[model samples]
Target: MYRAIRIHGYGGPEVLQLETLPTPVPGRGEILIRQEAIGVNYIDIYFRTGLYKVPALPAILGMEGAGIVLAVGADVTDFEPGDRVAYPTSLGGYGECRTIAADRIVPLPPDIPFDVAAGGMQRGLTARMLLREVYAVRPGETILVHAAAGGVGLLMCQWARHLGVRTIGVVSSEEKGELARRNGASDILIGYDNLAARVRKLTDGAMVPVVYDSVGKDTFVASLDCLAPRGLMVSYGNSSGEVAGISVRMLATRGSLYLTRPGLTTYIAQRGALLGGARDVFDLIAQGVLRVHIGQRFALADAGAAQTALETRATTGSTILLP
Candidate 1:
């Protein structure tokens, strides 16, 4: 038997329960992984609070993990026993062991540690999708990133800097501002008040061509104001709360702004996109251009506490759970 965090209903962190279950066996096109680390993301919290619904009750509550494959099922030829692999989009990752579809797995680089792989796969890919595909950020372009010290924000800043893009990072506090600057933010704005004014001033009143906003509701209006005419507003998350009551006129009044709510699954829906995106993320990390910080780690059984820390915004960078 192996242990996993199971949630029978939706609510707060208190709803997460650790339980033992029989080890799963790999079926056709599947592989059984001995999980080493699991990533904690806001999406997990969304699913936990019923903001995002699951398929059924008593479901495992995680989407990413790194592990060693112990067995491969029939027709699974790319992986074998003892292969080190990581997956960013697999469900049921908060467990000691899991059986996942082979197509979803990516082989981990030999030098990349399990913790880094688990912590970065999802977030790194997210940054890649946003910067590379979403707007195709150009060299010397200026952009605004909300929650700039958070996992995806930090990666986006560093990656954008590497590509010669200037980043104006919006952080919640001076400490987070410092963190953002260290990670490649060209300018930092603390707090949300007068956000557009600050961003405009930083960009010499021209405003930015894109605003990557993860803090929904509270920062939505200000994010729109920070954009240039016909700019893109990538609203990817809702750490503050859901963005609502948006009308077509809002976009027209905001200079023909374009808005998108892209998901990791949609960005990497195809096999080629999945492998290619993951490869780019891993390659950037291997080259040291992208530094992934494993800020906090908790034992698998303490996932509830981990979730609490994440929800309270008490942790920075990436948080992981060890099995």
Candidate 2:
């Protein structure tokens, strides 16, 4: 038997329960993984609090993990026993052992450690999708980022800098601002008050072509105001709360702004896309172009605490759970 964290109903962190279950056997097209590290992310909190629905009750609650494959089911030819692999977005990750679709897992590079792999995969791919695909940021362009010291925020700042873009990062405190600056944020704003005015000052009143906003509700309007005409507002997360009660006319009034709530899954829905995106993320990490900070580690049984830390903005960089 192996241990897993499961939630029977939606609520706070206390709803997370650790229980023992029989080890799963791989089904057709699946592989049984001995999960070494589990990633803690805000999305997990979303599912936990009923903001996002799980397929059923008593579901294991984690989106990403790194592990060694111990068994491959029938017709699974690409992976075998003892292969080191990781997945960026899959349910049932908050367990000591679990079976996942084989195609969802990627081989870990020799240079990338398991902890780093688990920590960086989702956030790194998210940064890639936001920077390269969604807005396709150009060099010399200034962009605004919310929660800039957070996981995806930090990665986005660094990756954008690597591509010659300037980031105007909005952080909650001076300490977080300093962290964002160290990770390539060209400018930092502490707190959300007068956010657009502050951004306008930083960008010489030209505003930015895109605003990457993960803090929803509280900063949505200010983020929209920080954009240039016809700019894209990539509202990818909701750390503050879900964005709501906006009409289509809001976009028109906001200088014809384009808004998108893109997730990593849609950006990498295909097998080729998944492998390609993961490869890019791993390559950048391996080459030291993107530095992943494993800021906090928790025992698998303490996943509730990990999620609470992430949800409360109490942790920085990446938080992982060790099994």
Candidate 3:
């Protein structure tokens, strides 16, 4: 038997319950991982609250983890028993043991710890795609990041700095602003009231070339105004709410700006894609060019509290769950 967190009916964090289930065995092209650490993300809240739909009830809702491989299914040769690996599994990550496709698992480097590995995959890969893939953020280029003290923000800020890029981070408070500045932001602004104007003033009347927006709905229209002519708006998440009622004509009106909703799945759809994206993230962490800060830790049983912290925007950096 193995322990896992599951929800039969989705509503709130209170719905997360710990239950024992029969241990799963790896089938063809699969592996069973004994989880060491789990990455807690805002999307987990969406899944719990039914904002994101799952095919069935009684779901195990988590997206990423790091663990030791206990068994590998037939035809798997790159990994063996006791191998340490980290994966960005699309589901079933909020458990003591998770079964994943063999190709989805990446062997962990010696210098990367379990807690760091789990935290790095989701957020670090996000930073990778944002800087290296989305618009190919270049040295000396300026970009804006929402929730600039959150997990992805911190990682992106550091990597952006390493690339000699300038970052304009938007935060909710002075404290978060300081955190953003410390993470390599050239400037930080409070995420309220005339946000685009603030960015314009900070950039000397020239807004950022790209704006990395995750707080959707509440900031979508404003984010459009924060971009420079022909800028890219990378809307990857919706912690505040989902972006709604998008009008394609607005793109033409808004200086021919480019908008996209990028996700890890699309960015890493195949092994080659995964390898390309994961290598950038893992190498940065391995070389100290990027830092993954785990700001909150919850026991497997306290998953509810972790979700509450994230949904309320009450935590910074990354949140992790220990099994």
Candidate 4:
């Protein structure tokens, strides 16, 4: 038997329960992974609180993890026992061990630590999708990133900088602002108040061509206002709350802005895309252009506490759970 955090219903962090279950076995095209590290992310919170629907009751809640392959199932050609692998988009990752579709797993380089891979894989892939695929952020262009000290934000900041894009990062506090700056934010704005004005000022009144906002509700309007005409507003998350009650006129009034809510799953649904994006992110890590910080870690049994900390925005960079 192995331990896992399972939730029967949606609510707060208190709903997460640790329990023991029989170790899962691999089926066709699947591999059994002995999880070394689990990633804690806001999406897990979303599923926990019923913001994102759970597929079933008593759900094991997590989407990413790194581990060693203990076994491989029939017809799996690319992996074998003892492979170091990590997945960015699999459910039921908050466990000591679980079976996952082999295609969803990416082999990790020997030099990349399991903890770092767990913390960065999902967020790094997210940053790659947003910057490379969503709107194709280009050199010499200025962009605004919300929650700049957070996991995806940090990666986006650094990767964008590597590509010669200037980033204007918005964070909740001065400390987070400093962290964002250290991660390659050309300018930092603290708080949501007068966000458009601050962004405009930083960009010399021209505003930015793109605004990658994950804060939602509280900052969606400001994010729209921060964009240059016909700019793209990539609203990828809802840390504050979901954006609602908006009409097309809002976009028209705000410089013909284009809005998108892209998911990493959609971007990497194909096996080639999945492997290619992960390779790009890993390559960046190997080059030292992207630095991943695992700012908080908790024992797997303490996932509830980790979720609470994440919900309250108490952690920075990436949070991981050790099994």
Candidate 5:
């Protein structure tokens, strides 16, 4: 038997309940993992709150984890018992043990700690998709990032800096701004009040070429205004709230801007792409080019409190559950 956090309804963190479940058996092409660490992300909150629908009422909610394989089902060839692995795009990670399709997971590098892998897998993969595929940020280009001290935000800052790109980060406080600076943000803005004007001053009235906004409804308009003519607005997350009632004319009026909502699943749907992206992220970690902070650790049964902390913005960097 293993413990799992399941939600029977869409609501707040209290909906997440800890219960004992039978250790699952792996079916065809599946591997049963004894999870060591699970990632806690905002998407889990989205599902719990019904902003993002769950497939069923009673369901598991986590999407990323690192673990050791205990069994491989029929027809599985690439992995075996005792293999170290991690997955960034799979669900049902809020458990002590879970079964997943073999192709959805990647080998965990020997040097990467299980907690580090769990902490950064999803966020790092999302950052790779954003900085390399979505906008393909060029060196010497200055871009704007929202929630600069956040899990994904800090990774993007460090990764973009490594690529020679300058980041103008928007954070909520001076402390967060300092953290972002240490992670490679060139400049920082404390809040969104008069955001465009402040960005203009920072850029000498030139504005930026891209704005990577995860703050959603609270800052999309201000982020749009921070872009240069023909700049791209990457609205990837909804931290404050979901953005709604957007008029297409808003794009036209805002310098003919380009907007995209990309997710990690879409970028890594292909087996080759999945492995390649994971390899890149792991390689960077191995080379010390990227550092993921495990800012908060919660026991598996304390999943509700963990989600609450993440939703309230009371935690920074990557939060994880020790299973």
Candidate 6:
């Protein structure tokens, strides 16, 4: 038996329990992997808090993980036992091992570590899609990245810089601001008190072409106001809380902004899309351009505390669970 963080009744971090279960067998189009690490996002907290409705009780709590394939289904031909892989599965990632659909798994770049690959998948892939598909940033264009020191934020800042785009980062604390700066944010703003004003200043009275926001609620309106004419508001995650309803006219009034709520699953709907998008992340990692910060780590058994820390915003960078 192997221990996994399983929740019988979703409620709070306290409810995440470590329970042992028999090893699972892979089905057609699936592979069983012994997880080396689990990537814990605030979305896990949302699942625990009932914000994101999940299935029946007693479910394992993870969306992404990295490991070595232990077994392959008879129909699976792309991967074999012992291949190092990482994946963003639809569910059940907190286990020591899992049977995941092979297409959801991607081979790791030679130099990337298991923890880093796990750390980078969901967030990094989200950033990749946001930049390449959501609005398609161009060189010399200015963009605003909210929570620019967080997991996805760091990747966006670096990846955008690599594309020769300038970014004005929005962060809560000074420490996070410094982190965003190191990650290639051209400038950083603290708080939403004078957000649009700061962004205007950064761009010399001209706002950015796009605002990538995960810090919803508190920053949504200001993020909208900071956009230049026809800019896009890419509201990817609700780290602050789900964004409230807005008037349709506000989109036109606020620079005719385009609002998009994108998730990794939607962005990679095509099998071809998955491989292409994931390859971008792998290439960035292979070239040493993407530096994922594993700022916090918890043993698989300590998933509860990790969830608590993430929910309270007491942690930064990518937090992971070592199995």
lDDT of 1 by residue, 27-115 (tens): 99999999999999999999999999999998999999999999999999999999999999877999999999999999999989999
Q: On residues 144-261, what C-alpha lDDT tens digit does candidate 6 reach at each position? A: 9988888999999999999999988888899999999999999888888988888887789888888999988888999899999988898988878899887879999887778888
Q: Lowest summed-lDDT stretch of 10 residues in model 2?
A: 307-316
TM of each candidate vs. truth: 0.99, 0.99, 0.97, 0.99, 0.99, 0.97
In angstroms, the error of model 2 at 26 is: 0.5
Q: For residue 205, what is the lDDT in candidate 4?
A: 93
Instruction: After superposing candidate 2 on the true structure, give the runs of residues whose Cα lies further than 4 Å from its correct spot.
Output: none
lDDT score at residue 220, model 6, on the 0-100 scale: 90
lDDT of each: 0.93, 0.92, 0.89, 0.93, 0.94, 0.88
Ranking by lDDT: 5, 4, 1, 2, 3, 6
TM-score of 2: 0.99
Stretches of candidate 1 off by over 4 Å are none
lDDT of 3 by residue, 1-323 (tens): 99999999989888999999999999999999999999999888888999998679989999999999999999999999999999875688989998999888788887889999888798998888888888798888888989989999999889889999999888999998898898898888886689988988888988888989889988988999988888888899998888888999888898999998888788898899887777778888888898898989999999999999998888999999999
Please identify model 4 stretches exceeding 4 Å from their true place.
none
Question: Model 3 TM-score?
Answer: 0.97
> By summed lDDT, which 10 consecutive residues of candidate 4 come out lowest?
195-204
Q: In model 3, where do residues sit more than 4 Å from their true spots?
A: none
TM value for model 1: 0.99
Score candidate 6 by lDDT: 0.88
Clashing pairs in model 3, backbone N/Cα/C closer than 3 A: none
Angstrom error at residue 304, model 5:
1.1
In Å, residue 38's CA in model 3 sits off its true spot by: 0.4
How high is the lDDT of residue 144 in model 5? 98
In the range 1-323, model 4's lDDT, one tens digit per residue, is 99999999999888999999998889999999999999999999999999998899989999999999999999999999999999998989999999999999999999889999999999999999999999898899998999999999999999999999999888999999999999999998899999888877787899988899999999998889998899999999999999999898988998898989999999999999999998999999999999998899999989999998998999899999999
Q: Using alpha carbons, what is the TM-score of model 6?
A: 0.97
